[model samples]
Structures are given as C-alpha cells and as structure tokens.
Target: MKAAVLREVRTPLQIEDVQINKPGPHEVLIRTAAAGVCHSDLHFIEGSYPHPLPAVLGHESAGVVEQVGSEVRTVKPGDHVITCLSAFCGHCEFCLTGHMSLCVSPETKRGQDDEPRLTSKKGPMMQYLNLSSFAEQMLIHEHACVAIRKDMPLDRAALIGCGVMTGVGAAMHTSNVRPGDTVAVIGCGGVGLAAINGAAIAGAGRIIAIDMAPGKENMVKAFGATDFICAATSADVVKEVIEMTKGGVQHSFEAIGLSKTAEQAFNMLRRGGTANIIGMIPVGQTITLMGAAFLGEKRIQGSLMGSNRFPVDMPRLVDFYMSGKLHLDDMISRRIKLEDVNDAFTEMKTGAVARSVIVFDA
Candidate 1:
C-alpha cells in the first residue's frame, strides 16, 4: 500500500510504498476512501506538536471495512465507517463513566512487544492517532471507527470523523449552547465554520464569526454566522463582540488554539457563560486569564473530540448531512489525490482553502 510518510519535521511527506498488517483481535482493516487534511496533522508536521517519526499522518477519514478481526462485532467486512482518533477501551474508568473520549488504557493499542501495524522498507512506520488514514488502508481497533450509512459520501463523511464532530460536538455536547443564545467563534477555518454551523443548528440567536481573512467573511456568513468581524483591523475584538450583542455572548469558542484567541474567547463570554477551547494548542504554552472573571461564574474548559460518543453522534451527523441541514458540499474547498498532500498542506498553511480532501481510488 502507498502512504504519505513524514520522514522529518517541516518537510514534505514522502509518498512511499508501505506494508499494512492484517487486523489483530478486536481490530478492523479499512480500505481508505477519503481522508481530510486537518490542521492537527499540520501541527505535528511543523513541530508545533511532537510525535514519533516516520509516522503516517492523517486522522480524519472514512472508508469501507476490508476485513475485521475475529473478535470484532461492531462492524462487518462490508460496512462503511468513519474513523476517529479517540479509540477507547470500554472497560476503562473513563469509558465506564461515559467519558469514552478520555479513555487511555493500553488495551486500545498494540502492546510494545507486539508487531507494529504498519512498516516501511526501512522498518515499522508509526501510525498517527491510531488511524493513519493517509495510507491506502488503515488497521485500527474496532472502537476507533463507527459504521455509518452507505448512502453518505465518503468525502463528506470524512469531515465528520474529526472537524465536524469536534465543532458541532463542542457546541452541543461540551458547552451545550441553547436556543436564543448568542455565540462567538474565533477563527474561521474548517473547525470554526463547523462551530458556526453548529451554533445555527443549536438555534443560537446571534452568531459572530471572527477571522483575519477578509474573503472568509462570506463563507462564514454562508455557514450561518449572523455577523462577521475582521480580526486584522479590529483592535478590540472582545469589546466589539460585547457591543454587537448589546452585552457579551452567552457562549464563546476558541477554535484557533492560540493563547490570544483563547483569552479573547473567555473575555467575550457573558456572565455565567462558558468558553470552550476546541483547538489543539501546542504543549507547554500557558494561557493567562483574568483572576476576577470567575467571580461572575464564567468558566473556561477544553473540549476533546467534541466530547463525542462516536457511535451515537456520528450517525446523527450523517443524518444531519442527508437531511440538508449540514452544508458539507461548501465546506469542501477542493479534492486532490494522495500525491497532492504536500500542496494541500501548503494551501492550508496559507489559510486559502477551507478543507482539501485526499480521495483514494476505489
């Protein structure tokens, strides 16, 4: 199988032939159909986040089950599925308490002594986020993927595996945005747009989209942003949001994962409102908050994978897409082949495209 392998940080991923192992007990082998090039993948590639080298780096994907391990019962050989990074060990303390996204038991991955799932001519290639959908196929734990309807397009379904789920789940699950509420989302990238769409779906009365890119204002409006704020010239974003809402927004989301934006999200929240951080901020960066802000009952929290229970939420997202409520077609800025992954990342770095999907051959 051919895969885009990250040989070094800040370098183009090498497209090379890689070997994928068969499914282990409780594992499933999926033939990759479509994979979304997400910002999280760029973070590790640019050394913003650290991970093992020679890894295949893609997490947001959807595919068809090529094979299943003997113990895998959640999906069959022919089922269509969306892969998630949050592979949970159902017996873990977190999973037992309904917080499956936080499960970190060793059972979810191959033991250190076990043979690696992927290997290149050099040696075993580390799989990124347990899915590594950048390759032609993915061998992952059954818990890492949820089977979805066959009618859903693999390209669009791929978005729900990560960005869509993260954005929508952040609003509906993490912060619990209510109808008639006002929401302000920082950053207008794929995740930010999804947050705005989620806010609309949640019936938020006012949705403000913030971005430095002037062109994105239109896209944001199309995604249900009630108003757009250009961050470039806006000296006081929090103040602008407060004035626009006649006060502060009921909920605020930081999707860019920057310290400044995260602080702004908290500052823009109304009294008793919640600020949800959805971006994967780099490790070791500290964010400072107003000490007196808590006196008003305001809170700031981190959201993991939209606090998702993939099995339940993924299908609902698929239904939402099928019902025409989720506008996925516009979200996909372009589609390219595996060889074009480097260019896609370059485009993403420029903040010129919403999402560039890697469509695999059937």
Candidate 2:
C-alpha cells in the first residue's frame, strides 16, 4: 500500500509504499476511500505537535470495511464507516461516564511488544493516530470508526470524521450553545465554519465568523454566520466583537489554535459565557489571560474532538447531512489523489480552502 510518510519534522511527507498488517481481534481493516488534509496533520508535520518519526500521518477519513477481526461486531465487511482519532476502550471510566472522547486507555492499541500495525523496509512505521488514513488502507481498532449510511459520499463523510465532528461537537456538547445565544468563532477554516454551522443548528441568534481573510464572508455566511468580522482589518477584534454584540457574545470559540486567538476568544465572551478552545495549540505555547476576567465568571476550557461520543454522534451527523441540514457540499474545496497530498498541505497553509480531500481509487 502507498502512504504519505513523515520521516522528520519541518519536512515534506514522502509518498512511499508501505505495508499494512491484517486485523487483529477487535480491529478492522478498511480500504481508504477519502481522507481530509486537515490542519491538525499539518501541525504534526511542521513539528507544532510532536509524534514518533516515520509515521503515516492522517486521522480524518472515511472508507469501506474490507475485513474485520474475529471479535469485531460493531461493523462487518462491506460497511461504510467514518474513522475517528478518539478511539476509546468501551469499558474505561470515561466511556462508562459518557465521556468516550476522553478515553486514552491503552486497550485501544497493540502493546509495544506486539508487532506494529505498519512497517517499511527501514523498520516499524508508527501510526500517527489510531487511524492512519493517508495510506491506501487503515488497520484500526473497531471502536475508532463508526459505520454510517452507504448513501453518504465517502469524501464528504471523511470531513465528518474529524473537522465536522470537532466543530459541531464543540458547539453542541462542549459549550452547549443555547437557542438565541450569540457565538463568535475565531477562524473560518473547516473547523470554524463547522462551528458556525453547529451554532446555527443549536439556534444561536447571532453567529459571528471571524477570519483574517475578508474573502470568506460569503462562504462563512452560507454556513449560518449571521455576521462576519475581518480580523486582519479590525483594529481590535475582541473589542469589535464586544461592540457588535453590545457587550460581548454568550459564547466565543478559538478554532485557530494560537495563543493570541485563544486569549481573544476568552476576552470576547460575555459575563457567565463559556469559551471553548477547539484548535490544537502547539506544545510549549502558553495563553495568558487577565486575572480580573475571572471575577466576571468568564470560563475558558479546552475541547478535545468536540467532546464526541463517535458511535452515537457520527451516525446522527450522517443523518443531518442526508436531511440537507449539515451543509457539507460547500465545505469541500477540491479533491486530489493520494500522490497530491503534499499540494493539499501547501494549500492548507494559505487558509483559503475549507478542506482538500484525498480520494483513493476504488
């Protein structure tokens, strides 16, 4: 199988032939249909986040199951599924408590002593996340993926796997945006646009989409943003948001993963409002905030994978798409082949495109 391998930080991913192992008990082998080139992958590729070298790097994807392990019952061969990075051990405390996204139980992966799931001529190749969907195939724990309807296009389904789920989940689950609430999302990328859409679905009365690019206003508005703010042109983004809402919004989301944007998300919140940080801020970066802000009961917190329970959330999200309420058709900027993954990353850095999908041959 051919996969995009990252051998070092701050380097281009090498497209090379890699070997994928068969499914073990509780594992599922999928024929990769489509994978999204997300900023999260760029983070690891640029060393903003660290991962083991010589790894196949991709997490947001959807595909068809070709084979399943003996113990796998959640899905069968020929099922369409969306892969998620938040693989959970079903019996863990987090899973039992309705917080499956928080589960980091080692049961999800093979022990170090066991044979690696992927390998190359050099040696064992590390799986970037539980699901390395950049390759032609993915061998992952059954819990890492949820079977969805066959009617949904795998390319659009791929976006639901990560970016969609994260953005929507952050709005509906993490911060629990209420009807008639005001929301300001800091970033109009795939995740941020989804956040705006999610907030609209949650019935937010005013949805403000913030971005450095002024050209995204029309696109962002189509996704349910009631207003658009050009962060680059504004003298003070936080102040502008506060004035626009007459005293700050009920909820503000930091989707850019920058310390500056994160602080702005906090500052743009109304009293008793919650700020959800959805972006993966690079390691070692600290976000400083005003101590007096706490007196206003403003709370800021991190959101992982949009606090998702994939097994339940993903299927419903699929239904949302099918019903024409999810607005996924406009999200895809373009589609490319596996070999063109590098160019997709190059486009992502510009922040012009919403998502670039890697469509694999059937």
Candidate 3:
C-alpha cells in the first residue's frame, strides 16, 4: 500500500509502497477513508516528540473496516469507525477505574519477539502512535477504534478522532466547566475552536477565544466564543482576561502548549478555578508557575486525549455534529490527497488553517 514514511526527523514525509501485516488475534484492518492533519503529528516531525523513525505518521482518522481478526468482536468488516491513539487494555487498573486513556498495558501491542505490523524494503516500519492512518490501510488493535453511525461523513468524523476529542473532552470532562462558568481558551486553531465550541455546549456563561491573529476573531466567534482577544495586540493576556471577566474566569484552557501560554492560563483563572493544559509541551521544557498562587486554591492539571473514553464519546460527538451542534463544517480549511501531507504540515506551522483532511480514493 502507498503510505507516507518519515525516515528522519525535521524532514518531509516520503510517499512509498510499504507493507502492512495481516491482523493479529485482537487486531482489525481498516481501509483509510479520511485522515486529518493535526499539530500533534507535527510535534514528532519537528522532533518535539520522539518516535522510532521510518514510521507511518497520522492518528486522527476515520475508515472502513476491511477485515477483523478472529478474536475481534467490537467491530465487524465494513463498519465505519474512528480510530483513536488511546488504545486501552480493557482489564487494566486504569480501564477498570474509568481512566482508559491512562492505560499502559503492553498487551495492547505485539511483543518484541513478534513480527512487526508493518515493514518496507529497508526494514521494519514503526507505527506512529497506534493508528498510522496516513497509509492506505491501517492495522491496529480493535480497541483503538470504534464504529460510528454510517451516515456521518468520514472526513468530519476524522477530526473527532483527535483534535475534536481533545478539545471537547477537555471542556466537558477534565475541567468540568459548568453552565454559568466563564472560559478563556488560548490559541484559536482547530483544538482551540473546538474548546470554545465545547464550552458553549457545556453552557458556559461567557467564552473568550485568544489568539495572536486578529483575523481569527470572526471565525472564533462563529464557533461559540462570546468574545475574541488578539494576543499579539495585548501587552498582557492574563491581565486582559482578568479585567474582561471583572476578576478572572472560572476556567482557562491552554491549547497552544507553550510554557508562556500555560502560565497565562493559570494566571487568568479566578480563585478556586481550574486551568487545563491540553497541548503537548516539548520534552524537557519546564512550565513554571507562581509559588504563592497556590494559596488561592488555583489548580493546574493536564488532560490526555481530553480524558476520553473513545468508545463512548466518539459516537456521541458524531451525533453532535450530525444534529448541527458541533461545528465541524467550519473546522475543515482544506481537503487534500495523501501525497499532499507535507504541505499540510507546512500550513500547520503558519497557524492559519484550522484543519486539513486527506481523502483517499475509493
């Protein structure tokens, strides 16, 4: 199958004919339908996150099941499914305790002695995360994906797999923003806009969208933000947010994953408010916080995959989109083919586009 192979760090993904293995007992083979280019994938490309090289890179995707292993029962052949990186081993402590995203069991992946799930002329090709949806076909654990309603567009559904899940889950689950709470989300990208939308869906009294670009105000407001603040124009974002809310918001979310913005998110919170960090900060970068600030009961926490239970949340997200509550239509800035993956990553660096989807030919 034709797939994008990242052979080295800080380089373009090469499109090549790679080999995918047959399904394992708990695996499922999916025919890639649509995959969304996300910032998280860029982290690996830029070397912010380290992964084994010569891997197929992509995670946010939706596809049709081509075949299932003998023991796979969650989905059948021909099912429409959204794949998630947070593959869980159902019997682990985290899974049993309702924190499936935190599961780290080795059972979900093949052992060292086993044959690799993918390979190329050079050698074994590592699977990025668990999905590796940038390829024409993905062989992943059955638990990594869930079947959604067939009518849902796979392109839009692809966003729900990662960006949407992270943003919405951060608002609805992690911080638990209430009906009358105020929320300020840093960064107006795909994840940031989804955070704003999620806050609205959670009935936030006021939602503020912050970004460095003034042009994004209209787009951000359209996604349920009651107000927009251009961070580039502001001398102090934290002060501006505090003044706008008369003291500070009940909740603030950092979606950009910068140390400065993460600190600002904490500083923009009201007393007893919670700050959720949704971005993947680079390895070894320390996020410093004020020592005295803890006296007021202000708390900062991290959210992984929006603290998601993909099996339950993904389907509901699709329903939200179908019912016109989720604004995925505006989220897609462009639709490209697999060969255009490199350009998509370039555009992501500009921070101008919300999302780009790769639609595979049937």
Question: What lDDT does the true structure give each of the candidates?
Answer: 0.93, 0.95, 0.94
User: For model 3, which pairs clash?
Assistant: none
lDDT of 3 by residue, 119-236 (tens): 9999999998888899999999999999999999999999999999999999999999899999999998989999999999999999999999899999998999999999999998
**1 or 3, which is superior by lDDT?**
3
Name model 2 segments beyond 4 Å from true. Answer: none
lDDT of 2 by residue, 1-362 (tens): 99999999888999999999989999999999999999999999898888988999999999999999999999999999999999999998899999999999999999999999999999999997899899999999999999998999999999999999999999999999999999999999999989998999999999999999999999999999999999889999999999999999989999999999999999999999899999999899999999999999999999999999999999999999999889899999999998899999998999899999999999
Provide backbone clash counts, one per model: 0, 0, 0
In model 3, the number of clashes is 0
Mind giving the per-residue lDDT tens digits that candidate 1 earns over 117-216?
9998899999899899998999999999999999999999999999999999998889999999999999888899999999899999999999989888
Task: Report how far residue 84 has shifted in candidate 2, in Å.
Answer: 0.4
